[model samples]
Target: MRPSSTLLLVLGLSSTLTACGGEARSQASASPVVETTVAEPQYESIEQFESAAIKRDVPYVPTPQETVDEMLRLAQVSRDDLVYDLGSGDGRIVITAAKKHGARGVGIDIDPTRIEEANENARTAGVTDKVKFVQGDLFNADLGQATAVTLYLLRSVNLRLRPKLLAELRPGTPVVSHDFDMGEWAPDDHKRVGDDDIYLWIVPAKVDGNWQWKDAAGRSIVATIEQEFQTFTGTARADGDRYNLRNGRINGAEVSFELVRAGDETAPVLERYAGKLANGAIQGRITAGNRQAAWLAKHD
Candidate 1:
């Protein structure tokens, strides 16, 4: 298969910020209207469905009610939040977000049939005014208005949309995914809702720079990170040798990614670091050779 297009693999959180000359709307404003798109049922199985959902291009299964409630519990949605449900299916998430959390919501789906079902569901739930379902591609939807986001997409799709979501939404926006994992990035919290797992991630503020860490051996390793908004490039330097590090964008208040180093002739063959970043500190599993250690990163 062809490598996923950045656009095809990712959900396009509305990057049409005022800076991009998108229709000027109040900051943190939640539109009372529900926005959605024409529908075309593309998949039947959960796996096939989510795979399409992640690309922000295909239609998939609607979120179950139990899952919606679980997302609310995890996100702690409130009246002030603007929630967006990508691949809204039957609008369960958006409607519930409005009904229970008192938050306004927008649901986007490619299937017009699903949009109709969502609208009816919103009305039946007495949340029509607060929730609206539009017929459109999630890839083309404007997610910047959302303070909270709920998804039931695929892992690859989540990874693809990862950068766009971070770039558009401000730090602290809550993102909840039902069954999908945001590759490379870590979630702040997660819980099991019945047999399913829900992951919650918060967008972190932009504060990327070079950081140096010292081991107990008195040897210092410096990591130079260049952040482009949320996406980043990092290199680790120890002694005279340099190594490339794997890194992912921040989702909300948390930063979770991976780092790896290959050994030279004189050195061992493998070194790996994986963990979460919070409050200027990094903590997680660090592996070098057969030994594993804890790691931390604090502000300079």
Candidate 2:
């Protein structure tokens, strides 16, 4: 006989429930406190990529493959070229240079992820042996090793990189840019690939040192030369007088300057210097007025 109670329970229960209740105790002990591990979210390297975008980013838009081929063509890239691509998005430029032209190259981009993607792209292109990619700022990237430099940066970035390009790249090294120009330093050549514009520049020789050379009459022309990239300005001292140099410019190995001899200046004499710069000397032909004579200038 059962009495009414506050607790609610069936008096009789299952016969298969382990007669000693051993199964319930075993189950309770088996279920120890479970712990889980959460993998930390992968973050970009602070040394390689900034948490916030810098002014340098020109967005991630890739240059068309056809346009890239055109750039290489216009630059006249050969087997001797060591092409360097600034802001290399997916390494297409350097890969193309290596695969298509058999040139060695390096692609640089500040974003680490972009560099990873670029390296993968290079591998897929089968140019991994010829080209490599790095993560770094494009503005400060080393340009000395490059025989040809490629750019797809904005106009402002182009202007910012112009000095480095002129200073580091060797004379006659071709620099090709897609879309943008280097301010006043005009392009040596231009071409259109489909609807895109490509510009090229041949780095001019450094004529920024003091030179001593003789005129046609052996005038002992000791000239002071100062250069800013391709443009130059300085006085040519001869005949106990200083002559001002006008229209002074350098294009690759080509140099030209108009010299006006002091007060008797009626019209400026055009002096065209065509020579090979080597052995710390500018040795070539100097054409002035109606006379064209052999000229040799030694760095003083």
TM-scores for all predictions? 0.55, 0.74
lDDT of each: 0.71, 0.78
lDDT tens digits, residues 1-300, model 2?
Answer: 112211111212323454447766666668787444557656557633452354445656678999899999988898888999999988999999998899999998877777888889988988888998988888778788899999887676789888899889988889998877788888888887766678899999988878888876678888887886678877888879777676677777777676667555575665666667876787778787778889898888
Residue 80 local lDDT, model 2: 89
Best by TM-score: 2
**In model 2, which runs have C-alpha deviations exceeding 4 angstroms?**
1-56, 226-228, 241-246, 258-271, 288-292
TM-score (C-alpha) between model 2 and the true structure: 0.74
